[model samples]
Target chain A: MTKTRLTRRALLAGTAAAATAATLKAPAIAQNAPIKIGVITDRVANSAMWATLMGEGVELATKQVNDAGGVLGRRIELAWEDDQDRPDVSATRARKLIGDGVVMILSLSSSTAAQQAQTATLEGKVPHMSPSHSADTLTTRLNNPYFFQMGPLASFQIRTLMAYAGTRFRRVALLTDNSALGTVNATSFRQGLQQGNIQIVADETFERGVTDVTPALQRVRAANPEGIFHAGILGAEMALFFRTYHQMGLRQPVLGSFNLSIPTYLDLVPGLLEGVQFIDVYDDVKPEVVDFANRYKAVHNKDPFSLPAYGYDGIMLTVDALRRAGAPDREKLRDAMHATRNYTAVIGARGTTIGFAPDRRIGFPENGCVVRTIANNKHGHAVWRGLAAS
Target chain B: MTDLLELAVSILEAGGIYALMALAYLVVLRPTGIINFAVGEWATLASFFSVATLGWWNLPYIPGAVLALAGVAAIGALTEQATVRPMIERGAPILTPILILLGMVVVYREAAALGFGTQNLRVPPPLGFGRIDLGPIAIPMQSAVVIAVSGIMLAGTWAFFERTIWGKAFQAVAIDRVAAGLMGINLRLVAAFSFAGGAAIAGTAGVLQAPLTSAHYLMGLPLAIKGFSALVIGGVGRVEGCILGGLVLAACERLVMRYAPIPSGFAIGVPLLLMILFLLVRPTGLIGARGRT
Candidate 1:
């Protein structure tokens, strides 16, 4: 009888120990399972650099998360699809990612492509975010609850720049190219100027191909406004604009849209952009930014631009939502993403954090825009970070 | 008056580049009567070659430029042999070669984009970015270099067409292809020479202008349109007419933008408007054929 009781107790203890060991092994097995995420990018387009920079940030952030044991005990796996910056291609890629069973999708393409991808995300009920597109239409054009935009909208950029330059110049001239984005940015800028009661002394536009901008510059020179607002986004056209502006000896202060935040200009338009201030979302002096830059450079062997911060924040935000949801359930993830608040954004001005309200899908704060100066052919420091109401 | 002087300088600076492209169009159009829109793509290809030889390999400007232009000329000859010659030898219509050249434009652009990617590539100016002042008139050194080089090229081209026996053969072919063929001039050889010369001129324009605009894959279409407009405005008959058309088109474009009280964006329409006006009102163009009577 004593031997039988001892054997029964041993069996009970052994069963309980085996059950605990199995429970621990379960998570490790799940951790080895890859939680696939999809990234739609423009690998070959006019805006390839921006796409590359954004994708680099995503890759860097994804590595960091996996290093930290990943979300929900699963390693994050990124499946990439090149959109070629075409809207149709972007939509098709988004659907294909959904079909491939990705938990979420991140897009870093033009606003048009991003907006098109929204249709696929909405139909598939998968959460989607665009980290670099600035067009306001991405959120407003579609009531896709699963879609979110993180970049500063065109209106926000123009308004922020106007607020920064308030009372500095009563009359300002606008210079932009005929490219679609340039035209759109210029129009938003025009509307902002009109609302500010500022006079536009001259409005000049140049084509993408013509190297000579002097005729347009001559007209602007004749008008002789107190300042010049550059809304052109094309690198070659903007280079022509600055070269012409410098050659014509125009002394008026030149302010630019947020497009200047692109780092390619530092190399493309050297020595021509000094003394020019452009609206940006990055504050180089921020500690978080410095840390991110260091880590990114260590991994990529190159300095990180402000644009990458958006991509980093995008992946982090999605992972944070995933962590809160604790499962790959699309509905729960969507709800968690929509509830994001007080999250620290690596990009944007000081004191600004990314959040999405119940009513709004655009995640960037109103005060996130900052004005940065260019000096010695490189982006300098933030000159102004406004908290004024939009 | 300063504005006027500066405007004139802008015209010259722009016209110089446009003239080179217009002349490229004229070269092929004169002898073959086939409008090769691929000249712009040839220029863009040369720009990419410059980026490789000059920017990547750190070659000196003169040798780098000669290599790029020569490479494009050879490519042009290959293109003629592969696409144009075969089609013509098969008794295809004149429109067949034109259409084939159009197809080559897309092929060349895609090849460059695939090889170099779609980023804008920067080439340092042959001269530094400083400006040279001619009294009250100031010109960027690159612009002045472009003007000087284009002037020499245009003069050389004029002499080639007028003074050289081979050039006279091209003119004779332009006047009447059947008569020139009847006169024992090899049509195939004439076609190859025209394509080679045209491609070289276009490539020179690309190498010179790449510093200003950066060599991009998408730069070809706009250039092709502008060059075609220049051809339409200057007339296809004379080499000098091509240069004259480029200058006039550039001048009118600037002058209208400067004094027309039109919105700055409207200035882009000036070239298209001029092209249409020339096609509708002055189809023979500003300089018609020398022996039209």
Candidate 2:
């Protein structure tokens, strides 16, 4: 009877030990450390509408990765910071994000602010991605392996516009506001036109906030260019220009930058903006674009602007790099980012096979622009594709 | 030469409006010894109200003009009574009254922004759109009307001050408020009258300029700067000097743009350069006293 009792006690002890081993192994399999991605944007917490859309993108991307069994059995976590459209503020935010163990950072907007964050990211050896800023200097002159841009650079868009203008118009005139962005676009456009064997009849600049553009437009009219291209955001100046241009009896075709099709421009000018053409990276009518837009609308109850799409794609690209790297190591991630060959994004098809060739750190697909023309003053229709060379 | 002539006409039209705004500033400055920084705000507010009256309410232009002018004048008088009169009663210094006007400027600008969104509105010109040709030079008909109205108002103002009893009372109050009060002139009434008149003139300028350049909350700042610059250049507190200064500044800017080797965008810099030159050479301005009081 004593022997049987001792055997029963040994069997009970074995069962207890087995249960403890299984519990410990379950945690190892179920609870992988989350990969932390730092998303620094100017949209969230600053503007209500932008905050919601951009926030949803980060949230959606994180959820998608987690739902798909995550990267290497580890779920993704996004830590966001608002730059508030200031460079100094963004730099401080980027440092804080780096200190918090974020492997990569995503900039919300503004080329100037992104450059500021990029400097900090390079110092910290953390990768930074910008969704909307297209400044060539960010990608070319300050080519840091840690930095990648998801949108087409300003030079690319300007070259495409100049190519089209060379074929259609004999002489092109440039009218730009006296802003940093405007000046860069104007200079790039001039260089592109020259390269394309097109002549510039006139180039004029106006004060940043000038409401009355009649005087400037009158001077441009005296030059009698085949077409006029205005490089500025659409607001009061755009409305004033259209009204004054119509009043002055100038029927020359007007081309504008991507800002021409923004909601503010449509709301302000209404019927006056008909027949205007602009260059954009994404068109809402395209199947891929429409699907994303509808999903964005369904989720956020508002149509997504081009900025949010770039932002979403930027986050996804970072995830792609992480997957390729197999870990969150800085050097490996940078290599994976640079080696991206052909990766499709919500904005358009981003070639993963093509990426930052050590010399070019910015990740932008060539021929990313699609030409859109205003049809009924309310909506813009895409008319051309693949203007920039691949 | 033809281009120069065309520019001159343009300058005259712009100058006429500036001169009117300057005169409005002088009307308040001469009587109250206070520079109403809110003068342009008053004009901006009146222009917006005029648009609301005509466009939103579907009233005729004449009624809208009258209502806007009268309403702005009343606001001016009330503001003086509520804000300025108490300070004057407390025997505050001259700068204190000026500061009050500066505060009013901020309040008025914010109020306008709150009342009307930041979007620019199109205000149709009061006169029909057409150009009147003066031989080789053609000018907008609106320009002629602005000049004519300014001349009539200036002449009427001169007559009132020089010939009428109430105008004499106003001048007496302006020259010496204590003495005017001792002589049984109602000091408060005269002060209110000056503010109302100044505001009305500003309202007229607003009504005139709105049709050419649409109304916006921020439009007042540049206009105020130009009007004040004219006031300083023409000799502070002098109506005729203000008019002359406005015309000279506008003409010089236009002429510089037409003939200067620099681009037209740099035209504003010319007036600023002239202002600096004038300050260095003739501190008293073209018509002001040579030395400090």
Off by over 4 Å in 2: A1-135, A138-152, A208-215, A263-274, A292-366, A388-390, B1-6, B36-59, B62-174, B181-217, B284-293
Per-candidate TM-scores read: 0.90, 0.71
Q: What is the lDDT of residue B27 in candidate 1?
A: 92
lDDT of 1 by residue, B128-181 (tens): 888888888787888888889889999999999999999889888888888989
Relative to the true structure, candidate 1 reaches a TM of 0.90
lDDT per residue (tens digit) for residues A38-123 in model 2: 87765421222233345567676677677787776777788878776577988999999999988888876466778888779989
In terms of docking quality, how is candidate 1 classified? acceptable
Q: For candidate 2, give the lDDT of residue A183.
A: 64
Which runs in model 1 stand beyond 4 Å of their true positions?
A1-33, A388-390, B176-183, B290-293
Candidate 2 local Cα displacement, residue A215, angstroms: 4.6
Least accurate 10 contiguous residues by lDDT in model 1 chain B = B284-293
TM-scores of chain B, in order: 0.96, 0.91
